[model samples]
Target: MRNKSRKIYSMLFLLLFLWGVLWEAESVYAANWGSVELTAEEAVLMDADTGAVLFEKNAEEKGYPASITKVLTALVVLEHTSPDEQVSFSHDAVYNVDRGSSNAQIEAGDVLTVNDCLHALLLKSANEAANALAEHVAGSREAFAEMMNEKAKELGCTGSHFQNPSGLFSEEQYTTAKDMGLIAIAAFHNEEFMKIEKDLRYTLSGLQRLPEGNILYMEHKMMLPESRFYDSRVVAGKTGYTRDSGNTLLTLAKEGDRRLVTVVLKDKSPYHYSDTSAMLNLGFQETEKQSLEDAEGFLEKIRAELVEKGTLTEETKLHFSSKVMLTLPKGETQEGISYLLLEEEAEKKEISAAEAKASDSGMPDAKDSALPHIVFLLDGRKVGEANLYREQNIRVMLSEASPKTKAAFFAVTISGFTIMIAIAVFLFGGGALYGAKNFADERKRRKKWKDRRKKRLEEMKISEEEFRILLEKRKKEKKN
Candidate 1:
């Protein structure tokens, strides 16, 4: 009987422990599970300022980014060149549909400013624009790719490696949702980048003519009116889709003082737009709740501490009076009750006397003269009252420049001009003008040689009969 009782007690204890463990597990699952449904392979919502992860779901999983890789491409271009700088397309930028997957319609010889190219790349997901901008910035796509990797390291994007400026498919070129979010946050800070990504409709001026002679227009995919996730607060974002990576989105949203960075990658569901929208909404709501809870706790602590100390006294009251009981005329001054002590009368009298004397003397109050007095003190002495008016016009002369200073300034200016001239000659004269001249000379030489051959033919004046006889004689000599 004793052994059976001991066995029953042990079983009851074991059951209770298992139940407790199960309960805790369920509680944890409940805390994490929200109303929003997420289909992304990897997703993250992060604080832009602190880089704090508010929520994450498989955020470290690697996935294809598709055209979203152009975000890094845009970042590299913006770092290297200004927006207004012109970029001319090359043969490399020509989209050849036969050569794998090429999306952009940009062709060789088309010209666009770097700013405009960036717009097409980010908003329209133009692969040709991405390549053109990359080549323009770093002289080659490979070098630009190296720069992108270097920048990734600098930005602490450990999970990303860029093989191309255009996010073409390669197993080696992959990034986690968290790393993409970080990159998006960094890119969003630049005004030019933000402008291009958020712009719904951008008319690219110089897309190459099609076979049909019609010009092509690049349109923003994310800015489509039919997109359910569209919000004015979304300053910038990139959207990407591929067979491997279903759909990916990186968005920056600002509402009031709150800024959110959201990244969703490899979503398997058909309603990607709605899924992202719900996730972002839930993230914002959760963050707000957390912030309010923190604020309330802090305020409660402060209130408690203040009440415990003498800082907040019960008699320190707010009196309320009805408007009807108060016979106050609009714009009329009323003298309220003044609290004073008899012991402080002398000090008050002195202050009032000084103020009255200033008023009677038609002089500005002491407070008005505070800045001037401070300036005078800074200058090591007070200027006379009359000189106060002149102080506005008085410019403090800097001491005479030393001989070394004069020499340095002259040297710097001369060197600046020298560098400027060298750059102008190398860029304009050596590259364009010299090439043009060389081409012209070659053409002239070719033309002259052709003229000489024609003159020789005319001088020879060989008739058709003579030419036929010479050809027969040559054929007979070869047979012998």
Candidate 2:
């Protein structure tokens, strides 16, 4: 009876322990799951300052980007034409848009300033305004579209293409949340763009088209001060919709110093705002920003190396052309961040013998002094990059000259039998060290040359075998 009781107790203890372990495992699984549930089919939460993705779901999936096209349209227009530039509406610009679609009702031959057009474009969601602005900037809608596509490519948008300036329904026109995010980030950098986006209302008083002042109210419901969904953190945003494309929104908001850009596409009514709010909250709760310049010790170490190598001098003014921002989870240390300094390829130019001599004598041409890019990675994924520049010219300093040159100078100064014997021993004994150093340097030089050759071949769209044959032929010609 006693043995049976003890066995029963042991069984109970083991079962309880097993149940506790299972419960803990379930808790951990729940913790790993994302904190927010969104209704959008494609969405992304990005750090506005750093361009770092905080959360994403099907961000690369292409979908119709209705009025959001105007955001890019406005950006491109602002890049080419000033805000005060006069825009004349043509018959095509006014009548090309669908009659039932939102329009500013400007007649052909009527004119308005670019600033007024942008107000109508953004606030009233006017299709005619977009068309008029496009024509004014590029002389024709087709050429303006080419500029848009080029701008998209420059912004690293691979999954997006623009067939028209306005976000009208087109089979070929589509964009992804990821691509729009990049475009929005670039646009936000423009002060005039943000200023236009942040307006609650815009009234165009002196228009050449309209006799009475046109009062335009904000079209974005969530951005309205009286709306229940209105968030004070929201700085600027754009909204879009079409029959084929469901409601889409690209919004920028800031909480404290942490700014977030949210893109939600193909979402049901009101859900885009709800989904964006949830994601923005999660981003603020989970992430913190760290400036790359704060890595003082790390930067000092690099600066010391640059100074020792004669790449820079103490008197040389180092002005960082770019500033890096790292966004990471709150409470997580910066141990995961890594950096790589990559020099940009300088343009190769042919110079006369006199010019070459001048270049070799501590006076490098502009083509010879390309700046370097500092790339930052978090958890092995690229987070951000910045350029490093120096105001002073690059040259070797006397104090930091290579040891071999100093030794050669010393050998030349001492000329005698004993000195000759010393030199012979030095040459033979130092051969091993010298050979190893030269081998390492040669490998670096070869790698750089190979990289340049590979880049050239890629640009020319040539095969490796063809490039090799061409290189050998050039070498033979040079030898001759």
lDDT of 2 by residue, 1-480 (tens): 999999999999999999999999875532121357889999988887877777888999988999988889988998998888888889899999876998875778887899989988988888989999988988888899999998897776889989889899898899999999988888778788888887779886655566687788887776888998888888888889888889999888878877788899898889988998898888888777877745555565556666786656776555556556777767656665777665432121212322554433543334324444566766554456665665553243323334554555456666666788877877779866887899999999999999998998899999999988999999999999
TM-score of 2: 0.66
Clash pairs, candidate 1, are: none
Residue lDDT tens for model 1, 256-309:
766777888888544555666666676566544111113234334433443465
Looking at model 1, residue 301 earns an lDDT score of 43
- Give the residue spans of candidate 1 off by over 4 A: 1-35, 96-104, 207-222, 226-229, 289-480
lDDT of 1: 0.63
- Which whole-number lDDT from 0 to 100 does residue 398 have in model 2? 27
Instruction: Say which candidate scores most in TM-score.
Output: 2
Candidate 2 shows a clash count of 0
**Pairs clashing within candidate 2:** none
